[model samples]
Target: MEPSEDTSAVSPVTPPPGCPLHSNAVPLYGEALAEDDTERWERLRKRFGGLAPVKVEPEVAAWLILGYEEHRQILRDPHLFTHDGRISRELLEGRLRPEHGTYPLVNYRPNALHNDGAEHQRLRTALVDSFEKLTSTRVRAAIEDLANDLIDAFAADGKADLIGQYATWIPLLTLNRMFGQEDRHGYFLCELMVKLWNGEGAEAGAADQAMVEYLTRLISDKRRRPGPDITSWLIAHPAELSDEEVTQQILLLIAAAHDPTTHLIGNTLRLLLTNMDLRFSLAASVIQIEEALDVTLWQDPPFKTLIGRYATRDTTVAGYQIRRGDMLIPGFAAGNNDPILRDADGNPPHAQRPVSRAHLSWGLGPHSCPARGIAYQIAATSIATVSARLPDIQLAVDPGELRRRPSPSINGLVELPVTFAPQQPLARPHRAEPAPPAPPAPPAPTETVERPRTIGGIWDRVSGAVRAWFGV
Candidate 1:
C-alpha cells in the first residue's frame, strides 16, 4: 500500500445530540497524555456514569463505555462492535479519504486480534498452536539458561539495570528464536516495536522506514533458510494464509510477547519487594504465584488505559447512541479496579475476581489473546523461580527512587536496582537471641579505622561509575 501523509487522520462520525456523554474532550493517544490526570478521569467517569455518549479526541468520534459490565458486554458482543473498522482497505486501494491517512493502515487486515467470527477463530487457532509449541518444556529450560547466564554476567557486579540487562533481552531473544531470526536483530526489533507502538509523526516517520527495512531483512533471511520456527512454519503452511498475513501476525505476536512480558517482570519484582506477605505466600505455592499474577494484572494492568473499538452499525451502548463509523475507548484500568470486582469480605481489599482463570489481562471474549497459556506459564515459572531462588532480592534504592517507564499502556520500572545477600541455604540460627534483651539496646555506629563498601554501598558505587561513564 502506498503511504501518504495527510493530517486529518481521524474524523468523527456525527451522532445524535441527545447523547449525554457528548464531550469536547479529545481522544487519548501517544502514551496517554491524559492517563494519570485524575480530574479528567473523574470527569470521564461521571460522564460515563451519566450514560452520556461522548466523542473522545486524538481519535475519530467514538463512544466511551465507563460502566464495567457494559465494557465487558461490548467485548463479548462483537457483532455490535467490530474490529474490521481499521482503515487499511481504503488506503491500499488509493480510495482512502484524506482524514484516514493517519491510520497505521488505510486497508485493514483481519488479524485475529482485530477480527471476530470464523475468521478470528481460524487465525487464532493456528497462532495459538504455534505459541504453545514454542512454550513447551524445552523452551522453559532454555529461558532458565538465558536467565542464569544474564545473572552470572552481572549479579557479581552487584548492580545492573534489570530491565535492560534481562527483561527486554530475554523476550526479544525468545521471539527471535521463534521466528528463526538472527539474535543480533532482537534489540532492533524491540526498538522498532517500541517506536511504532509508542510514537507517531516525525519520530514515527523515521522509525517507520527503519522498521520496514529491518523487518524486510529479517523476513528475507527467514525465507531463505526456513526452519521449524514460527515464521518458517507459517511460510510452509500457507494453505489459507498469505505471506502478508503471516508477516503481520508474526509482527503483532513478537511485539506483544516482548514488551508486555518485560513490564510483567518489572511489575512482579515491584510487587514482590513492596508486599512481603504476598511474596512469601507466592514463594510457597505455584497456585499462589498464579493468584499474585491475577492481582497484579488487575492492580497494574500492562495494557492500562487505552482500548480501541469501532462501531459496525449505529448502536446504543451504555445508554449513549453512537452512529455507524464511530470509535470507542474502554478504560481497562477503570474497569479492572471497579469496586464491584473487589472482595470486600476478604482479609484485605483485594480484587476477588478469580486469579486462577478469568482475569481480563489476556483480554475477554473473542479477541482474547490466544497466547494466554504461554503468558501464564512464562510468568508463573519466572516469578516462582526468582522468588524461590532469591527470597530477599530487595531493592537497593528507596522504593520511590526507582524510575518507571513512561508508557501509558505498560507500567514498569525502567531500571530496577536491587541488592541481595547472596543466595545461601537457610541455616538454623546457631545462637538464638537471648530473650528480649536485644530490644533494649540501641547503639550508635562506631567510627571505623577504615571505611569499605557494604554490599548495598558497593552497588551504589557501581551505579555511580556506570552513570558517570554513560553521562546518564
Candidate 2:
C-alpha cells in the first residue's frame, strides 16, 4: 500500500480480547443486521469492532465492515480490495457456487462494477459517456409522465398498496424508456424476473435462462440498428465494449440501480405516511423532495449491506485475519450508524434527520454508484406525483404492522397500504386539432468502432427478489 494510515493499524495475530472465534461469528443476514435497529448493531460493534466476522450464508464466512473509516480505507484502495470476485477463497474451495443464492452477487462478471484498474476504467467510461448523453430536462419529463400514468391507474380506488401499484411500476417503465424498449418488452422482462426471483431449484434456473434470451434479443437489435437509448450509446462509445459488456452493464443497471431506487421511494413514502412531521413538512413546503429522500437514505437506506469486496492479499483489519481471498461485505446500515460519523447525541427520526449528510447507501470510493442523479430524478418525481394527486392519503394499517422483507435481495418495508378520499384523475381534452409532432429520437450511433468477432453472451444474475420485493 502507499503510506499506511491509522485506520490500517493491525493487532497481534493472537486475536483481540473480545473478537469472536470463527466458529462463533455472527450472521450477516440475521435480525441484528436490520436496517433501523441501532441497538443490535451497537452490541455487535461493541463485541467485534469495525471488522466483524460473519457468515454470509450457511457455512460461508466473510467479514462485515462496520467502521466508517475502516470501510473507507478499504474502498479507497482498489488494487488491495477488489470488486472482482474470482479470487474469493470460498468460491475457489467449492464452498460457494453459481447455484447458491449468494453466488450471483459475488460471482465474477465481466462488467465495470466487478473490475479494477485500466480494465475498470474502460468499462466504466462506456457507462459514464453514455449516461452523459442524457438531458436532465428530458429525463425528468419522462419520469413525471410515467409517474402520472402509474398513479392514474389506481387514483379512482379509495385505497392501494403503494409498493405493488406505484413503487414497482415507476422503475420498470422508466427503465424501459431509458433502454429504448417498448412498454410491452419491460412488462415481459418483469414477468420473467418475478419467476426467476421467486422460483427455486430448476424453476429459478429456467427463468434465469429466459432472461438471458430476452436481453440477447435486445442487444442483437441494437447492434443491427442503433438508436437514442443507453444500449445504443454504449455500442457507439469510445470504450469499444463488446456485446457481452453492454449486456452486463444493462443487467447491472436493472439489478443494482432499479431495486435500490424503487426501495428509496418506498422508504420515503413510508416515512410520509407514518411520520407526522415529515408529512407536515412536505405538505407545508418546508422541505423539498431531495431532502425527504435524503432523510430515508440516512436512516433506512435501500440496502443493509453493499456487495462483496475481496482482499487481493492477506491482511489484518482491526485484528480480523483477512486472507488473500477473504471477502469483506460493506455493512451499509452499520456504517451509516457508525457513531464516529454521526453526532454524539445520536440520530433523530425523519423529521429531524439531517439533509445532504454523508452516508454509505450508494457505496463509496471509485466503485460508488454512477446513477445517483438519474435514480433521484425518477424517485423524486414518482413520490411528488403521488403526493400531489393524493394529498389526503394516510396509512391504512398500523405503522407497526409494516414488515421488512426477510429476503437477502431487498432492504425496505414489505408493503405500504394507504387509503385516500377517492379523487378524480387528471383529465385530458381531446380536439379535432392534432397535437404537434413529437421530437425526433436520438440519432443513430455515428461513432465508429471495431466489433468483436465473438460477442460473448451470458445469463443475468438478477434474482427474482427484485421482482417480488421490487422496492429497496
lDDT of each: 0.55, 0.72
TM-score of 1: 0.73
True lDDT of residue 380, candidate 1? 65
Tens-digit lDDT track for model 1 on 41-114?
A: 55667655622243322323445555568678877877877666452222222333333322332224446766
1-472, model 2: which lDDT tens digit per residue?
Answer: 1211221122313323453434657765545345555675677799889888777666567788888888888888898899888787666656665445576667666788888898889998888888888899878877777676666667778899998777866786677778888655665665565556567668777767666666666777787888898989988888887787888888888876556877999999998888898789888888888898888887788887765898999887888667887778887777877777645566443334457556777778889888888888888989988888888999999998988776443677767999999876566453232211221222243454443443322333444433332322
TM-score of each: 0.73, 0.84
Runs in model 2 deviating more than 4 A are: 1-21, 29-36, 200-206, 344-354, 429-472
Alpha-carbon lDDT of model 2:
0.72
Return the top candidate by TM-score: 2
Off by over 4 Å in 1: 1-43, 50-61, 87-102, 105-107, 191-210, 221-224, 344-356, 388-390, 401-408, 421-472
